[model samples]
Target: MKIIDVICSKGRTGFFFDDQRAIKQGAVSDGAAYIGKTATAGFSAVRQAGEAISVMLLLEDGQLAYGDCAAVQYSGAGGRDPLFLADDFIPVIEQYIKPQLIGTEVANFRALAHQIESIEVDGKRLHTAIRYGVTQAALDAVAKASKRLMCEVIADEYGTEVSDREIPIFTQSGDNRYENSDKMIMKGAQVLPHALINNVKTKLGENGEKLAEYVAWLRDRILKLRLSQDYTPVLHIDVYGTIGAAFGNDNYTAMADYLESLAELAKPFRLRIEGPMDVEDREKQMLALKELTRIIDERGIGVELVADEWCNTLEDIKYFADNKAGHMVQIKTPDLGGVNNIAEAVLYCKQKGIGAYQGGTCNETDRSAQVCVQIAMATQPDQILAKPGMGVDEGYMIVYNEMQRILAIRRAKANQ
Candidate 1:
């Protein structure tokens, strides 16, 4: 019942994070494709320079299972940030993360999973990025050994029944979203068209105008694309905390005023803004988000606030839910440690009467994307983002096609 080996291998990403449409439309710079995909860490200049990390767990009985790790831009500060980077992840998983689990007993999937999540280096918890990979591999190992689907392992472990149903497909977008949006509707997807505005204010000298332009483009896309549904597609803009940095808590009046201005452009379109701002103090930051949500709620604006930063772990998720910081909170899969944690967070959102979006970085591999789809279907989240790439076509196919496969299998088994 003990793990015999752990292997970590290298891989590459599909595209660097870029707003191609914005670039084509002259909203952002030509260099933004590389610069915009990065976080404040000022690490690498290569925009799409990402690594795919796969963790394989070998049991003593020659049974094996594995999972892939996705590299994310804007992973924030701390060892946990950029936890999937090749130099950071490979050595740690091989030297530190592996040894601890290689000989560990796996009699209980839930308990072993907890130990992996809690395993720490230098007195700090294991970086969440590695936790994501190892935990999924561990779960996969155990689930496959039991001849059950990964979600089935989750259901039996958590005392819930597996709900074999189709989960809504949520995919990310670049500036070339018009073409991507057309393809999304063709495949029956609920699109989350986004605009990256973190670098806009600095490069363009005016953030609002650029954001407005992006919003206007989205409005037109919605109109001409003839979105298959009656409800408008949710327009998301990752402010990367630039907006919050520009307008501080001391300037609450200004903050509300600017947010209202943005809302005006997204009028009648369901608007959700991610990472509006970030602060050094997490509790204080959550409070600010709560207050902002309060303002938006009181005004009855169409904009719904979402928390990405400061909302990584289970505690962070519960804190945001309890305080009502956002109408919806992104339960970022990689940030939260593992898949089961997402299950727990989504349930917490449900209990709190808030929305949950199952999210991950585009740096993820296709295997991880498909695995996430299985987990999302088990939980039935409000929405789930396509992974491992910026282009809507491949990411969309990886997820929805898997969903189709799983549904087909279930139907066949049920009829038999």
Candidate 2:
């Protein structure tokens, strides 16, 4: 279909409780560099820091065709306090993107994406964000034209079929240092069919005192569900030093023993641990990781080492492969660049005979999620991390349901 018009919407959304600090930190990073020094200085300084969401729409034959929402932090240069609100991005979408996309064919997704990327902000490329908008627009169009649910379109396009049996969606959770993990797990539970809850570090608050008790509770809950039969139910744990630090220096040995105990208890439930190594202490982290891996290996338990902050780019992936850092590589799209970049990383991991998990993101919507799923399927990864809507006000439930539908359709076609 030919693109006729583009419509872009900009608004504010609520932030996830745990993500506030991270979002503020990101805003500060941008604010330090861009606020007062650039043309957007005045605009950026007055803006309030909150959840930013953008919606763009593509039309078949109109001046107002494409639309999508961009939700992220905006900063004022010089480390200013007043951050840019979501609304600050609307004018840019209207002034720069609207005119360019008008009268273009909807099917020329790549060309349109490139055109959007060509638009620059503050002498740096905004291609990543622009491509995100284009993908949203294309998915919106496909959903409308096919007269199918967003999930159905995704399934049809990717050749994956979704089954009614619950699918286990894993996410991490904890407090203080592990707060982000907690929010991610709770959000994942809300969005996916079945949640493989990751009880992260237990060295914080009175909560730490009840770590063992809570794990037992969680274990019992899973057993009651009997999720292992129909769904891939696996509990994951992240063994970063932060957890050890919370409990004090002497707690490191104790924590390792606790993990061994937890693993033994989790054996019957088929629980897997995903240890994301902290790169800060390279030597120590590697040694601890090896010990953990060996323990799991001896017990014939599955363990995946997710390189989060440790592996951000292609070179990082290579390093992990070279050193045999972990059993599984976690692929985060934005950090790796575009879809193509992530695909290459997956290929590299596959060649090394390592499993891959399409990592979660805070900035993905329906469109971005589908693209992630497509990449995951194409790579044939063992597990795909499901982020869904996460903190987005759009609600992850809707986004995930749509994804399941699309995955179902894609699997059906692939088999046929």
Clashes of each: 3, 45
What ranges in model 1 sit over 4 Å off?
15-42, 46-48, 59-63, 78-83, 103-107, 202-207, 227-231, 245-250, 261-264
* lDDT, candidate 2, 20-53, per-residue tens: 2232233222422322222333442323333434
Give me candidate 2's TM-score against the actual structure.
0.61
Best candidate, lDDT-wise?
1
Best by TM-score: 1
The sequence of per-residue lDDT tens digits that candidate 1 reaches over residues 1-416 is: 77889887887765543332233223334543443333434344434466667888888889878887664544544123543466666887787788788788766568878888777779977667677777788778877777777776777777666667777777776555567766665565665665445554542124456666667676766666664448566677667666766666545566667777778887667678887766756797788889888988888777878887778777888998899998888888877876668778888898899888888777677877877877776777788887767788898889888888878877787899
What 10-residue stretch in candidate 2 is worst by lDDT?
Answer: 190-199
The TM-score, computed over Cα atoms with residue i paired to residue i, of candidate 1 is 0.86
Residue 186, candidate 1: alpha-carbon lDDT = 58
* TM per prediction: 0.86, 0.61
